[model samples]
Target: MKFKSNILILVLLAVFIVCSVQSVSAANSHNFTTDDNFDTKFADVVNGDTFTFKAGSYNLTSDYLINKKVNLVAENEVIINSGDYRFNFASESNGSSVKGFVFLGDSNNPKATTPIATTGPTEDITINNNTFKYVYDGVSFGRYATNNFEFTNNIIDGFLRDALNLGGGSGHGDVYIVNNIIKNNLSAKDGIAIAYKGSGNLTINNNTISNVIEAISINSFNAPDLNATVIIKNNIFDNVETVIEDPNHSEIIDSYNVFNNSGESSLTHTPKEPANIIINSTISKSSISKDGSVNYTVKITNSGNRTADNITLTITLPNSLKYVKTISKTTGDYKNNEWTITALDAGSSATLSLTLNAKSTGKQTIKSSSSYLNGNETTPKEGQTTTILSVNKLSTKITVVVAKSAILGSTSKFKITVKDKNGKVLANKNIKVKVNSKIYTGKTNSNGIATVNAKISNKGKYNVKISFAGTSDYSASSKSVQHKVTASDLKIAGVKRIGKNYIVKVKNIGDISSKSTKVAISFKTDNKPGVIQYATVKVKALKPGKTVSVLVKFYINKIYSSHKRNVIIEESKTFKEASYENNIISIRK
Candidate 1:
């Protein structure tokens, strides 16, 4: 009986222990669905409790503090409209999260309080996918050493101050901000999209920010001991005055960012230094001829504040312009298109002159920049000057020849001659001939003649202008000539046998004159084992619609009964004619 009673007790104790463990596990979760105030309920929940909020709008008059290591999650779209209230996270709020909630601020209260503020040193706090709209400040973590804090995938809009201010004190470590859309903040002075004043490393990646005064501002209150490493990668900035405004003593690693503003710099930073050197550059002449050279004056002045040591001046010359020599009071070295000034003392000016020869023509821009060695504090000075160079123009003349009258719809020969001022013909020159507003371009041959064949479709007086576009060694010139175009067609009418001599009649059937024509006549014996003969005659010029006859006497074989003769008016390949099919005729007797 005692053993059995002990067994029963052990079973009851095991059941009681299991029930106790289940109750303790069930007490870690608190779910609230009503529209009641969650301030008292949140306080009643134990540390490390999972507080889940249902889908509803909760109006709060005071701040909701997530003081312990708790997870405050929303089941649906939970909107928290605050009336002079905000959400605060305490120092013990490590490993806590407040995600998937819309934080609406009270615009009536114009004070600079963040919608989500961190009160004490909080670490490993993840606030993701939360929207803060019309809030004075988006997320403010007061000067505390917070580590491993992540604020990702959040939409922060309409914040008066900073959209995300991680500045409270120094020594914050490993804050990852990724994929957030922040825009339209009203605070011009301190309204930055992501401002980091802490000392540890920050990674801001894949965020789209626009319409803010400054996109990312990194200023650590002149704290020399505080050195923060900020890595901003793959973020887009549009319409922001400055993408990054980093002061001295902060190391920023920036890459793969798309900035839409063309006028401003994508990243702007000033190094903190005790001494600075200012450089100014000026050009002697703004315009120079291609044969002339320009003088560049670079002045390096120390503003009486600090002695700049090992000052180096780099001057980048324009393309196709050779650097001649440097003319300066102080000795400097010019090598590989850069001029280096060794050093400059405080409260002094170093003036240097560079002479550059313009090798080609066009506009050339010269850029001069200065940098200081031995850990200087001031920003580098830069200046630019543009020199417009006029191309060297050579005295030239163009002579064009077109026949007094050309055959319409027939190829006309145009010869263009280009010469220098001394009447010496220029070889291999580009010549453009404009005939009645039609342009024809060709390079002159070795004889300075550019010959072109053109057919005029209409009969009229046309103006032909020949132009020589000058080279670097020559000048451009043009000359004009006039020619009347008329129609002309040449054909062979017939071949007549007049008293044992064959006469081949060639006629020009249209207007204008045909020059340098050739007529060929062939005579063949109309018998077995035929004998063939040919004769070619040249006609100097034939007038329009005029006939000219040529006689050909052929001795046929006495054994043949009759003779067959063929006459053809040959056309010149160099000259274009109207028709060639009617230029042949046959005769048999």
Candidate 2:
């Protein structure tokens, strides 16, 4: 029994040891650190190896050749500082991938090389999650047949030439470039974000591209013989000169792409439609009085090479204006203030004019749009013109003035004077006094003076407008004045010190009378103790536009001579004034 147990323990220990050895060999098989010659180390790796590099910088002096199907992955931050070409994948290196590594080239001489270049026929090559910066060309592939190539989730920036240049030659494959950010390749002639020339199926989806001369340039080498299919969708393109430059205009399916701040000529393609129609609308007058008529002209021109068939122009009028009649040639119905015209030819314009009467007083807009009746596949082009129709008020000369400046909560008399252009008074006319949308009506006397009384409560500048409706002899007019309702203001007019006696004059320049007002005079010496002298004089009542003098005597001391002294005349708090900022006067000695 002891010998059987010993044999069982030995078999278990041997199995455990074999498993441990295999685990260690698998871990060390495809892991590499930074070495002096990384290109040489990479060449020694076998086929189908998943080699991972540690976080460090590897300076590549010469181009590394990819001869077999392998994966070059970075564990963390790995950068390849290359001089010219970084990797040259041969025809036999099928299904190889390079991911999660940053490739940096010489910025001063960026036009000297590319980051990854494919020489011969390569199939199923994926370059993803890698950043290529300051390279001449980020990736250059073609000249031979390549199939099923994918370049996704990669960032290529600051390239002097094209970021992904797939040149023309014998090639039959589908090239997919998805979810990549390509920017700042500013070459005027050939610095495109993605350029394709050969006959292949190309798809660019969900990529962000900006700051390039051309975002995508597609040109077929042998046009009637070799045709390429391109599918571009869900990409954001900004700050690029041109979004697409398809010279041959191949079969392309493009939709749901966002383009902002790009050039005006975004898509350069041959039009498949019959005509391109442009509509323009103009008003005879931008502003007209109420019940006045305005002429609106809508010009529909077909600017395309082919004649437009069954083209329709629709004009929509605002509720403030009513359509009167059509003055020009029209072929459609005018109902519900909308005019429609049908049919415009190529390089010809159909001018339709309609007179509209101003119904109300405000700004009104006339909207007109035209479209080809063949289909609604394209958006209809629109144009608009705004007109302002005001009420036809007379243009008489009107003057609005307060009869006298009044106090708050007091009845103020406002006089409105209306005159015609010949300086004659318009008598027995109706005038309205509008104070902040509150209307007060009165009739002018024989002297053309309309008087209205209003209780002023708000203490601010009021825009008082006097309007005169037009009569048969005079035009309508309105004039406004900024009338200020203020409290009773008390001010010290003048101050004089004569023979140790201070005389102060107080005045009521405000519109109301003041009662029980006290004027005070005080002097202070600029010493450490600050000796002060004070006196007060009481005035029983002061009327508006009136003045009074108060006299106070103070004995001058030697302390007042040695140091600087200040004398101030101030009104007491018995009355509230309009402005207290100028109430006190200071005399410094």
Candidate 3:
């Protein structure tokens, strides 16, 4: 057991020492100055290490090989003098980055050598912020299939053949050449800014090339199956023999690329017109009621020196609004919320009007913008807002008309009418009438009038109120009128029979005089229990506490022979009565 434990301890110690050594090697870094030999320092670097060089000039004795994936960084004003040979980047130097270095070439052998060249398939290579002066070729990849190469923010001057060149392989990946400045003072007829012979997607954007024989050249060795697409945009070329030379007819997409010499003999593409777009928007009404409509207008102007073509405008509406029919337009038709204009002259303007309805109530926004040439040129987003306010109901007036004076125990007729503030009659409206403690409810007729009948029981002044409850578009209202009730009640006093004639006496029991009315007397015989006989008598007038008598002739039935008979009196509509129970009297024959 002791020997086994000693073996375990030894293995643990060995593992710890090996891990420490691997950690140190992985994090290896070096700093060099002009006193160190360049070849010797480069040979000592392993993969994934960073080497920093101080500012100085170091002339290479021979070609230096970068065979490791390392980062080579230099301070400002560091110059590497390559007399005739180049710094070769081998296949093992993939994922390497070189930055902030000024490379000076041999001026005597400018056409015979390149400063930085690739010897094999090197990928994910970045060479940025470098200056190549008096070199035959700057960063050349010869006949090797390479991809994912980024060459940016570089100044290449006085190149004899090409500033940046790649080719000699069947498959090449996407290459991005951006923000580069390439020019030369010499008028070399064979000088080219960029030359790509392989097949892949090449994007050359935001680059300035001037005073070269050819700005860009793409040749796919007459192979149509490669399907290479070259996009050149936002590049300015001046004093060049040809802007682009595509010998193999590969797919080239060019836009917003400015060529200064438009009338050059060997120009391939037409110069793009310089134009600018301006958009302004407005609304007819900013605030509107619910279900109301507003007009949204968009005015597009070309504030540029050249005419703009194929301008498309789009309008975006919020969810609270519904799109209605268009009103008018100076140019172009609007369909599916989009409008297109074929052409617009310089300094000209166009207008479009659209009608929109408010579907709900809230703050709504409308946005509009214009684009041309597949978004190569665009106007800023212009917005305008409209507010949808809730509608308030209209004011209504209820007018109640009733008799000024009414007799006691009489039904008073009330005329209730409803109308709006503009005197327009409203029909089918609910009405409530309260007479003292009695309430009546009904709907108005087509003439906006409702009849309410209520009994006037008291003998003094009272109020008759008429109320109207509002609807969705109308408001509530109420009105009251003064009604004076007079006292006039008729009662039957006595009944006398003479042969077939009967005399009835009626009296006014109320304080006021009674109006002319009729009295009806009914007789019932005991022989025929279901038989009844009736006679009506007319009473002219009766003052307070005064009596009046009239004769009512009622014939008897021969078959009905009985000694007992019953006589009852009832008042007609001509006058109201205070008590009806005392109007009936019993008589015996």
Candidate 4:
């Protein structure tokens, strides 16, 4: 894009000099002009020259136009940076258009920011297989470039607003933009990446694009209705947004895509449709709300190109509302039809109704839901809908009661009873334990209550856990409560088998107080049929060394009636040094 139009005037005169990059295909040519001016080394040669571009930067503001059809390749690593700050290349009016060059431009242009525009109608100006870095505009197919070209496999990374633009005339230009990366930069004034305007066959396919203001636009807005049939398929518009608007040309056929669109205004789509949306069944409205003695009905219709069968409609209402359904069938029957909403289709409006009342007072909110089925359970097309009711003012009541106690014993039953507007138990409702695990477990009863039962096994100090969870929603209770269990609270209850089949006991035990210590009890003679002792009982006050006669019966015949077997009995106490005894008399027959 370096031809200034007027340069042909100077070259026409004998005084003008010409330089060409024709024989660039020769191997390993690092033939840099050792002279400050590279005029001698890079001048005049023509078509079919292959050259390689080495790894480095290039800055060219000089006017260098390809006047012949030549192949200028970027060798293993060739760089063209820093030159006469002007248009780098221009095609001779009718000479061959320059094709094939890996031109790496690093032009530090602070003023001229517009991408170099190709002038006039240039044909077969193929720009492919090159990596452009930090240039004014990577490459521009300027106004009216009717070139059947291939802009493929080029990585343009720079600071121009638009990495590429293909703006053509009405029903005129045909260009194929394929497989190129135009990213890593920004432009102030509509740096459109690719603006297609010509009325030509343009196929932009299979490439990655990112971070550009106007990434890809098929701008038929400026052109007459004679717009070009553009095919933009298989490309990623990652992190891009813009004015890509042609409501008329937005029908895209998509298949196998991972496309993410963040732009609110415009979007890009391919010409052929890959997937279409099929509505299983369509309803007149999404949802509705109603109050006292309300009736509403909608017609279910099939809105797809294909026929829908056996559509079922179900409605949900607030538990407060006692509803009556009057459908011809619980499961709807359908004929293969384009559209059919029974209520609206019935010449007049058919209706569905509900009879309702406020269960509680002072603003009640109830939600009813509904679902539609394909009528077949296994492959049913289903969706849910909900309606709500609001009561301005009403009367409501709740009752919480504790069940009557069974005679005061070691275990106390605490029942959490609840009643609705009416005093009736709604049994077997789930409740949570608001108290700590060490203290309580929210229990459920057959008669709709959360019963928290506590066993008092200690004496003296008492602590309480009040469980407040109830059985059901109507129960009106939280899963929280206060409880008091103490040493003096646990009944002095436990059994000791003094004689066979005789479980004798101690009395008057209460909530927990002092720590307990156990005194060992062992019978001097081992008895057959081993006896199992299940834990020791805590006794706060007991005679220390008194001969307490505890009856002993045996499974064996009671023999040796006089031989006194040493009977050992140990006692336990809290807050006292425990004393034991070997002085126990065996009462034998």
For each candidate, C-alpha RMSD in Å? 15.6, 18.1, 19.6, 20.1
- Candidate 4 regions with alpha-carbon error over 4 angstroms: 1-43, 49-61, 82-117, 170-173, 220-226, 246-257, 264-589
Clashing pairs in 3: none
Q: What TM-score would you give candidate 2 relative to the actual structure?
A: 0.40
Identify the leading candidate in terms of lDDT. Answer: 3
Going through the candidates in the order shown, the clash numbers are 6, 5, 0, 81
Give the clashing residue pairs of candidate 2, or none.
394-475, 394-476, 394-477, 395-475, 395-476
Candidate 3 residues lying further than 4 Å off, grouped into runs, are: 1-24, 185-187, 220-227, 262-374, 377-589
Instruction: Please provide TM-scores, in order, for all candidate models, with all chains considered together.
Output: 0.42, 0.40, 0.45, 0.36
What clash pairs does model 1 have?
142-168, 143-168, 143-169, 273-377, 394-474, 394-475
Give the range where candidate 4 is weakest over 10 consecutive residues by summed lDDT.
337-346
True-structure Cα RMSD, model 1 = 15.6
Candidate with the larger TM-score of 1 and 4: 1
Candidate 1 has a TM-score of: 0.42
lDDT against the true structure, each candidate: 0.73, 0.74, 0.76, 0.43
Per-residue lDDT of model 4, residues 1-589, tens digit only: 3676568666665343333344244433333321333343346444443333334444554655554444445434555552324323344422233233344444565224433345555556566766656665666555554556567877777646556655455335457788888775545565666766666677777777777666666654455344556666667766666524454473333322235553654343433322111222222222222223434343333332233343334443345544343333222332321112222221122223223433432233332222322221234444443443444321123233433222223465666654434445555555443323356566446665666666544322233434334321332344333344333111212235554322323322222232332222332233432442222222344332222222334445422222322222333322322112221223332
